[model samples]
Target: MRRVRYYQYGGPEVLTVEDVDPPAPQAGQVLLRVEAVGVNFVDTRFRRGPGSGSIFERPLPGRPTGDVVGTITRVGPGGDARLIGRRVAALAEDAYADYAVAEAQWLAPVPENLGAGDASMLAMSAPVALRVLRSAPLRPGDTVLIHAAAGGVGHLAVQLAKLLGAGTVIGTARSARRLDFVRSVGADVAIDYSEPDWPDRVRAAAPGGVDVVLDAVGGPVLQASLDLLAPFGRAVVYGAATGKLEHVPVVSLFALRSVTGFNLTAWRRANPDEARREMDELTDLFAAGRLRATVHAGLPLTEAATAHQLIESRSHTGRVLLLPGGLGPGAA
Candidate 1:
């Protein structure tokens, strides 16, 4: 089996694929014949560090961590044997590998109608999207702003916002095409965040102020989003992709504006049953036509470096996938 690994942290070039014997799953884990891997920006951050700050404490010889959609070929002790041959999606152990192990209880069954790429979102992105939106006080008719709104979770957040009764969905991305993709996915307005006066544009669109913000790109962007919130509005911070999570300012909190931080693992641990319900709801939404997963590109496993490059550069509009089991559904 081929797996992506990095001995030293640096640029995309550091990631190298090596052929190795596949390992068996440990107790409570299931071995999967990975069909596709979702390439995420966080993998790039982990690849560039001996310690990727407070969020990721990755060590040497690190591999990408991501969502994987595959078939359960074998089950380890404590795992259900009946799951063998079941198509499912889970956050994989050493996710970039052609074969990986996943926690059996944490995994979700992939609906027959859903493709591999969309199923991958069910593992991580879609649930996060749904949770972050719900983290804040999101009411019907609220105006919502989704930063990086054309990326994996952002794209899904845009649609879910509308479905959850957001009156106006404002999306922010770096490129024209990304803005268009956000619009295509039901955003009421799309703005280019790369512009210096982008917040002004957002202000123009909302007129009063944004009611809710779903932010992953922290730092100045997060601060700006917080600054633009209307009275009684809320902002949910889920990630710090900019490498800096900002501190809330006193002024931003005035006028009843509030900020909340969310971590997927934390949320799952804190609200196990509700977390499971959220996952099921997202999966069901995708299974129906209510949700759509926009895939930017599906490349071969060998091009893991290129996938990282796309994510790091913010050039892709949605989830960039890797085909580990060759070209299948949602893979080119």
Candidate 2:
């Protein structure tokens, strides 16, 4: 089996492709003949360096990209035999390889309407979007603002917010192209956050400010998101892609506004059953044609470095994927 690994953390240049023996499924796990792998910003973060108390706690060379979709080839002891040969999406570690082991509990059957690339993309982003929307105090006709709305999770969040009855769905991206893509994904309005007056534009669009703000971009954007909230509005902080340190100000507590941080990894760790339920809901949405994942690009597993570069550049819209098993070039 072939896999991508990094001996050191720095840039995309550190990624290397190598052939090695495939891993076998352990107890309560299943071995997947990986068809598609979802590349996310977190993979790049892990590649750069270890953050405090994060999964990347060390600088050890290893494979990244955990979101995977494929057919089950083997089931370990205590795993359901029926899973063999079934197409499923799973949250697995080291999924950049041709074959990866996933815990059976994290696996969900891929719907007939979903392709391998979309399924792989949905494995992580959809569930996180669903959970975040569900956690917020949302009401019909409410105004919602989503940061990084053209990226993997934000795109899904836009559609889910509308489906859940948000009256005004506002998305922010760095460029017109990204904002246009965000609008196409069900955002009622899309604005370029790169402008110094982007928050002012959001306020003008929403009138009395937004009722809910989903922020993945931190730093000054986090503070701006907090300021854009209406009275009693809620802000959910999921990621700090800006690489800027942020702290909630005491003044943000006025007007009954609240800032809450959501970490999907921590949520999954704390609530496995809830996580599975969210995944099922996302799958149902895809099956019903109410939701779809936008696949920006698909490359060979060996081109993991290229995928990372694209993501880091923020030039690609939607999810970027990697096809294992030598499925390269024209896969997209």
lDDT per model, in order?
Answer: 0.88, 0.84
Q: Quote each prediction's TM-score.
A: 0.97, 0.94
Q: What TM-score number comes out for model 1?
A: 0.97
Each model's number of backbone clashes? 0, 0
> Between which residue pairs do clashes occur in model 1?
none
Model 2 over residues 1-332: C-alpha lDDT tens digits? 89788898889999888899989898999999988888888778888876522544455775685788888999998878988999888888888888999988778898765776568755788888877877776789999998899998899999999999999999998788898899899998999988999988998998898899988778899988888899989988877776665879978879789887788778889997888788888888888878878888888888899999999999989989888765543234
What global local distance difference test value does model 2 have?
0.84
Q: Which number leads on TM-score? A: 1
Model 1 residue 309 lDDT score: 91
Per-residue CA lDDT of model 1 for 1-332, tens digit only, reads: 99999998899999899999887998999999999998888889988883556666587888678899989999998777899999999997588988998888679889987887788898889989999988886789999999999899999999999999999999999888888898999999999998999999999999999999988888899888887899898999988887885778887697898889899899888988999998899889988979988788888899999999999888898889999767765552
Worst 10-residue stretch by lDDT in candidate 2?
50-59
Which candidate comes out best when scored by lDDT? 1
